[model samples]
Structures are given as C-alpha cells and as structure tokens.
Target: MPRFMGFVRMEEGQGNPPQALFDAMDEYIGKEAAAGHFLDGGGLYGTEDAVNFVVKKGEVTRVDGPYAESKEVVGGWAIMQYDSLEEAIAGQQDFAELHRKYWPEVSMVATLRQIPDEPPTPAED
Candidate 1:
C-alpha cells in the first residue's frame, strides 16, 4: 500500500464551512477510517499564531504570522493509504466532491500527492 496526503487549500479568512459540510465529512471520514484507508486527518487553525523560520545567506530569520503574502493556505490535510494511485485519486476526488456539494459558494482545492516510502538523498553542495 502507498500512502498519500491531501492538502486542503482555500482562501484565507473565508470563515468556516457549513455545518452540513462538517456532518458529511464526519460520516465520510468514519467510513474511510473503518475501511483502513484514512490513516489520519484534521483541520488547522488560522495562521494568526503561525511562525516561520527563513534562512538567507547562511543566516536564519524568524517571521511570525499571520502572513500577508498568502491569499490561500492549506487549511486541512489527510494521510491515507491506498493500493494504487488511481484508487487514491478516486478517494481524494470523492472527498473533494463532498465539499463541493455541501459548500457550493466556497472554493476549495484538494491537492493529493503520494508520500515517498524512503527519504530522498540530500542535495549536494
């Protein structure tokens, strides 16, 4: 089985989705979790208290959020496992569809990508 991550991106400060959406999501997650496909997932708070560390010219600088540069941020994510990429895609599509159906006015994107089984080699200097 291959593990994949679904990054849920949406506009900042849009407020929460509808209760119906949450209810639907709860049901969906429950079903998938029971099937052993959904490994873990959760929503994230706004970037109001976020912190970032940037390195430039071998110097480290700390920057605190809420960041002004981002119009959209990843508000949620999921770690899931599937037998094939196609199966993962379909599962992710179904997850996205729930948001589309329950929150028609809001725009959301579920970016799905597989998690590598082993660490990659570090870049050479």
Candidate 2:
C-alpha cells in the first residue's frame, strides 16, 4: 500500500462550512477509518495564530500570520493509505463531491502527493 498526503486548500476567512457537510464527512470518515484507509487527519486553525520561522542564509526571521493578502490557505490535511494512486485519487474525489453536494457555493482544491518509499538518488553536477 502507498500513502498519500491530502492538503485541503481554500480562501482565508471563508468561515465555517455547513452543518450538512460535517454530517456527511462524519459518515465518510467513519467508513474510511473502519477500512483502515484513513490514517490521521484534522482541520487547522486560521493563520491568525500561526507562526512562521523563515530561514535566509544563516539568519532566521519570525513572521506572524493573520496575512491580510492571502487569498488561499491550507485549511486541513489528511494522511491516507491506498493500494494505488488511482484509488487514492478516487477517495479524494469522493470527498470533494461531498462538499459539492452540501456546499456547492464554496470552492476548494485538494492537492495530493504520494509519500516516497525510497530515498532520492543524488543528482550529478
């Protein structure tokens, strides 16, 4: 089985999703967890309370969030395992559909990437 990370992105300050979306997600997550496909995942708080430690050269700069100009942000994430990339994509597609059915007015994007099982080869100069 291969594992993948799902980054759920949406606009900042978009507020909460509808109650129906949560109810639908509860059932969906329950099934996925029971099947052992869902490893772990959770929603993240808004950027207001976020702290960023950026490194440039040898110096580190601390930047506080609450970014007023950020139009999109990662609102949540999920770790899941599936037999193949297709299966993982289908699973995520189903999740996106839930939002469409419950909260069609809002837009969302879920970026998926596989967790590499091997170390990368060093590049030649």
Candidate 3:
C-alpha cells in the first residue's frame, strides 16, 4: 500500500476558516476515516505562529513568524493510504470541492506526495 500526504496550503493573509468550514471538515474527516483511507490529519493555526530556523556553516540562526516571505503556508495536512497517485489526487480533489463549498472566499491548494516505505528488516529482528 502506498501512503500519501495531502498538504493544504493557503495564502499569507487568508485568515482562518469559518466555523461552517470547520464543521464540514470534521464531517468529511469522519467519513474518510470511517472508509479506512484517512490515517491521520489535523488543521494548523495561522502561519504567524510558526518559526523558521536556518543553520549555515555550523551556525544556527532563527527567525520569527511569517515564514516563506508570506507567500503561502501549510494550513492543514492529511495522511492517507491509497493504491496509486491517481487515487490520492482524486481524494484531494474531493476535499477541495468541500472547501470550495464552505469557504468560497478563501483560496487554497492541496499538494500530494507519496511517503517512502521503510526498509526491510535485515534478517531477524
């Protein structure tokens, strides 16, 4: 089985989703989880709450919030098990439709990536 992560990204000033969107998302998550496709997922706070650290030449430097130059930040993520990348993409499309219904004013993009499988055991573990 292939595992995929749907990373939800939103613009810097998009703000938080409305209560209706939250309710809809909760219902959606339940349905997906019940179907056994969804493994784990959750929404995140605004990007202002995030921090960025850059280490160069053994020197660690940190910068405060508003990372990525305020272009876009991940607002949520979902881990799912699927058979193929096409299936993963379809699942994300469905989620986007739900978001469109609830948050018409806000724009978002969901990116999907496959999770690599762990290496096999040596001989006996």
Candidate 4:
C-alpha cells in the first residue's frame, strides 16, 4: 500500500486549536482505521520549537526556527496508508474540509509516496 504525508499549515500566532483539531483528527483517524486506511498521525508544536536546517557548501547549518516565512507554518501532520494516490488525495480533501470549518486560514499539503521497504537511517546512528 502507498503511504501519504499530510502537512497541515496554519497562520502563526493564530490561537492553537490543538484540542479541537485533535478531536476532529481522532474522529477521522477512527473512521479511517475502521476502513483500514489509517496508519499513524500526530500534531506538532509551533515553529519556535521546530528545528530548521540548511545544507550549504557541504556543511549543515542549524537554525532554531521554521525554514519558511509564510503566514502559515506546518502546524501538524498525519501519515495515512492507502492503496493509491487517489485514495490518499481523498483523505487529504476530507481533512481539508474539516480544517476549513474550524480554521479558515488552515491549508493542507499532501504527498503520496510508497513506503520504502527499509527505513532511512538517522545521521547520528
């Protein structure tokens, strides 16, 4: 089955709707799991807590903030296992609708990719 990464973006300083969003996400995940489409999902903190890294001249520079300066930053994300890109997209659309209801400025960016047979190794490991 193919896997999808759904990135949920929201405006900075917008009140964190973690509880409400998580509630809706829980419901969605339950339904998807019942349908055998859900794999795993979770929310993330603000950009201040997220790390940013850039590779330049074979050297990596680490920054203590989000890499992007758009009004919206990645607020959270979900990974869904599905049979096809269409199915993954359908799920993204559904989540987008839910977000629209509670967060008008929220935007969802989704990418569907086949899960690798072997997981990528961490640099330190």
lDDT for each residue of candidate 4 in 2-73, tens digit (9 for 90 to 100): 776777666677776656766887798899989888777777777877777879999998988754565777
- lDDT string for model 2 (25-79, tens) is 9999999999988999989999998898989999999989988888898999999
What lDDT does the true structure give each of the candidates? Answer: 0.94, 0.92, 0.85, 0.72
TM-score sort, best first:
1, 2, 3, 4
Model 3 Cα displacement at 9 (Å)? 1.1
TM-score of each: 0.95, 0.92, 0.83, 0.73
Best by TM-score: 1
Higher-scoring candidate on lDDT, 3 or 4: 3
**lDDT tens digits by residue: candidate 1, 1-125:** 99999989999888899999999999999999999999999999999998889999999999999999989988999999999999999999999999889998887789999999999999999
lDDT of 3 by residue, 1-125 (tens): 89998898888777778899889888988988897889999988876767778899999898888676677788889899887788888889989988899999987898888888986568976
Candidate 2 least-lDDT 10 residues: 103-112
lDDT for model 2: 0.92
Regions more than 4 Å wrong, model 1: none
Off by over 4 Å in 3: 119-125
Arrange candidates by lDDT, highest first: which order? 1, 2, 3, 4
Error of 1 at 75 (Å): 0.2
Score candidate 1 by lDDT: 0.94
In model 2, the number of clashes is 0
